[model samples]
Target: MKVSLFITCLTDLYAPTVGMAVVKTLEHFGCQVDFPADQTCCGQPAFNNGYPEHARTLAQRMIEVFKKADYIVTPSGSCCAMIRDHYPHLFADDEVHQPEALEFVGRTYEFIEFLTKILKVDLTPYRLPEPVDFTYHYTCHLRGLEMTGDPCIGLLRQIGNCRFVPLEKAEQCCGFGGTFATKYPDISGAIVRDKVQCGNRTRAQVMIVNDGGCAMNIGGAGHRYGSTFAVRHAAEIIATALEGGKDNARR
Candidate 1:
């Protein structure tokens, strides 16, 4: 499969290792992964901040870059949802772009959903060096994209002795709604604080989030309070399982 990596702006800048892991994991499953160098932000931040024109400009660049990709995969559920669910509306009035927009969104898949549902690659060959307890935070767009069942957990189950702990209100947002967190700091801060608190309550050593924004938000808060739990991106965990096992998975 010719998989094109739509490494989100967050991953490109903040968590490039997760993006690298995604490539390694996909290649391990026999996929030919391509990293389109010119790809930029997926336009979700601008679009969510009520700047559709700016967002459309950003979207046009991505549309041009990955149109020929056999599969457009990204570690971001938020971006996947934006391109898949919102891009059509963003271009609804433009007859020239709408059809192609639909086609592009159809080809886009969030990394976890692509790995679990679309690719269905077997993971029996990978396992953790030690059993680790993990709790999943359901990021917003994964649910919006109908990426239900927290597919990452199912993927984790394939790893040897990885424990899945139940988190209270797993579907709740971590309060990092792009610029929403910046515009409404108090509300966002409180939401993320409560979310980290909830994850702490689960007593899971590792807190897993599908979206980088959520992981950063929740993980940041956890670190500030010196919470015992460690936060990680799903791609990092999966890549660790494939590469080094549990010891290397620790951040």
Candidate 2:
């Protein structure tokens, strides 16, 4: 399968390794992955901030960038959700780009969803080390996307002796709604405080989530507040497995 990777803005800027990990994971499963350089921000920042015109500009550019791919895959569920679930609404009234926009959305899939549902790739061959206790923070966009949750949990379950710690309110937002964090710092900080508290209560060594924005918010705050737990993306965890990390060590 020809898979085009949409390295969302956050990954391209703050976490390029996540993009590399995505490529490695796909190739590990025998799929050919390509990165389209023309791809830019998925425009969720502006869209969520109530600037549809600017969001549409970037969204249209993204659509054109990956129009030729058989499948479009991304690591961030929030960005993927923007393209898949929200882009169509952005072009609903326009005939010129409506069909193209819809097609672009149709071809896009979150990484785990594509791997487990469409590709059905077996991950056991990656050789993950003895696992440690960790919790998963399912981002709002992922749950809202309505993709199957089993792929993530099922893959993690394959790790040797890895404990999947469930957060008290796993589905609740960490309150890092992109621009929301900047606009309302107090509320955002309060939300992240609770999220970190939840993870700390679990006594887990790390907190894993799929959204880059949330990871930055939670991880940054966790570091600032001297929270011992680390934050990482699911792809990073999978990369650790492939690299043979013991106790989920850094690769």
> Against the true structure, what is each candidate's TM-score?
0.94, 0.92
In the range 22-46, model 2's lDDT, one tens digit per residue, is: 8988887778899888788989989
Model 1: CA > 4 A from native: 244-251
Pairs that collide in candidate 2 are none
Weakest lDDT window of 10 consecutive positions for candidate 1:
242-251
Candidate 2 lDDT trough over 10 residues, lowest sum = 242-251
User: lDDT for each of the candidates?
Assistant: 0.85, 0.83
lDDT of 2: 0.83
Q: Report the number of the highest-TM-score candidate.
A: 1
Candidate 2 runs further than 4 Å off = 148-150, 244-251
**What's the TM for model 1?**
0.94
Candidate 1, 33: how far from true, in Å? 0.6
